[model samples]
Target: MHDLIVSPFLDGFLAVRPGSPACVRLPTDLYEEVRAGADNTVPAWLVQTAADAWSLDLDGKAARSALLVREPTELAFARASWEINLYCNFGCKHCYLGERPLAGLSWDDKVKLIDIFRDSGVLWLQITGGEPTVDPDFEGAYRYAYRQGMMLTVSTNASRLWKPDLLRLFRDCPPYRVVVSMYGATEESFDELTQRKGAWKNFRKLMAAARNAALPLRVSIVVTDDNAHEVDAMKAVVQGWGLDHHVYTNMQPTFSGEGDPLLVQSTEFLRKRPVFEGCNAGVTFFHADPHAKVSICKIGRDDQIDLMTEGIDGLRRLGEISDRLMLRTGGCTGCSLSGSCRVCRPLAKVYQEAKAPLGMYCQHGDTKEMVHP
Candidate 1:
């Protein structure tokens, strides 16, 4: 029920609103004072500051319902992404998930998982799936995470964005952002790409509803051989809606090392990725699959920690796991171009396992031939 959350962030303390991006960093002493202060009571100065920062009319004696102060923890995480379920209504050939199964934690277990995220100090949580919005317990899980004071982002296909219940939930408690994937600019191409009829109609409704509700929406233009021809048209459509968008040109093999998804790659639209600089991954962030199995990152699923059994304490091993995963061993060992490799070790391993063409991910491939003029 709190409107503001003050929690330990990295080496400092940060104050953030649940649905908003604006954050205020508090000094260590101030954070300690807030934590040690009487229950439901915040400093008068903070109350005034919060009111001004978020434009809320806070009482002089800030109640616990208005402000939440989380105790400091040994956990270093500030962000995490969870796959609530792996089910989807549309079957896109380029999907990396490959198989779409309706499986996830129970509602009771889901509540526990959300609590674990809070206890582990996850501030920014992304709710994703084959299609997150279509999950049966999506509403319950989303609401619980929101109430727990985690800033959320939902990744979806926008097929169900126009649903009345979903609209009401988002209107009441907006997500940090709703990231929708754009398959095509026209109905025919859209349905063709998703292999689902009426998908375009649903997408149009989703856009209109989101615009009318004034929701924070961003688009991911997914370019594949099927929809590559509509790339410009897709951008124009999103631009007309006055929404921000990012183009995703590269397609990868499926998580299970299947090369089928690679076949759909739009070589003309493919963009070169930057060199792989080390990422925080398991150090500061981790990914949880539908079964609550934790991995350093989405691509590196080896040596997973079962959150359901190990609980939050399980995250302790992630740092070491991350270090080991980043090592240039296995298929990457003795490679001369490792320094300039665009993909991470884990992703490269996936490509190697699938026997994917070097042209798809390796710099040794002819870049000039792949890039469009």
Candidate 2:
């Protein structure tokens, strides 16, 4: 049978290009699918080889064996998300944390957690929060992690970063990424999501600060019904700023509060095109919340394994969970949600119907269903 090796470049559609009659790359080996339509697409051999290493398993393994060997690391990193806080000032219509950042760990607990992550060789730590910068000890925590040789990332609203000291801190030790969420191009659109009047101004200033620092930055805009038309305009603005970035559309609804009730689209008016396949949350990446909760995707934090206690083995155990949720869970087995689910996991606490899947959002002119549960 023909063998296919998946690579980081493959997302949403490319995966299914080889269609049901393709093969894929596994961690320790290759996975050759007798029927490739659902899992992947058959691209030109050169294209596939350039993105991934693959070969035809002419040794008759598929004929003799129904089971295939797979590796999790090929898709998932050891650690991707570092939950810094549960609290967020936005109290967005859809909030996954459910609660705000309540209490923080003691200094000892903080040190221990960082120590564990360091010991595990986790270099990229995504520092998120209801608002991570809001953490009373955010600077301290960031310094500690930096000192430990961990690269940092922050997902924030960009409102709290106006302080001169904070700006300097970012300039000196800027995160590998500072993913600022821009809800809209105008105040009306943005304020609706953030429910704050000055948010637009704050975000703009935040961008200015980053520009002044010449720090690396990525602007993440959540496309909803209201601002879907402005996706390209927004992207152009970021581009005009001369920053390296990608604008993405989330298929999942907001975790809490009023969700984005925007209609899904098939065409691309914005720079961000429709991602036919969903995220590979568990398969390609994983998250560890501030509470030490380990999940396949950041949105799957509600129902998750506490990695703080379970450790690396616990992450490995998640492979079974990911497969079960993606493969055996009825309609979701081969749905379009697979591509955008870069942050998806089976450990979510909420469950929606098959057609009305959890975290449903618009993509490619269709209402692409997503799962957070």
Best by TM-score: 1
Where does the lowest 10-residue lDDT sum fall in candidate 2? 12-21
Writing each residue's lDDT as its tens digit, candidate 1 over 202-265 gives 8998799988988889999999888889999999999999999999988877887788888888
Q: lDDT score of model 1?
A: 0.87
State the lDDT of candidate 2 residue by residue for 6-80, as single tens digits: 322222111211112233333212233322423333334434442453243223233223221122232234346
Error of 2 at 166 (Å): 1.6
Per-candidate Cα lDDT values, in order, are 0.87, 0.55
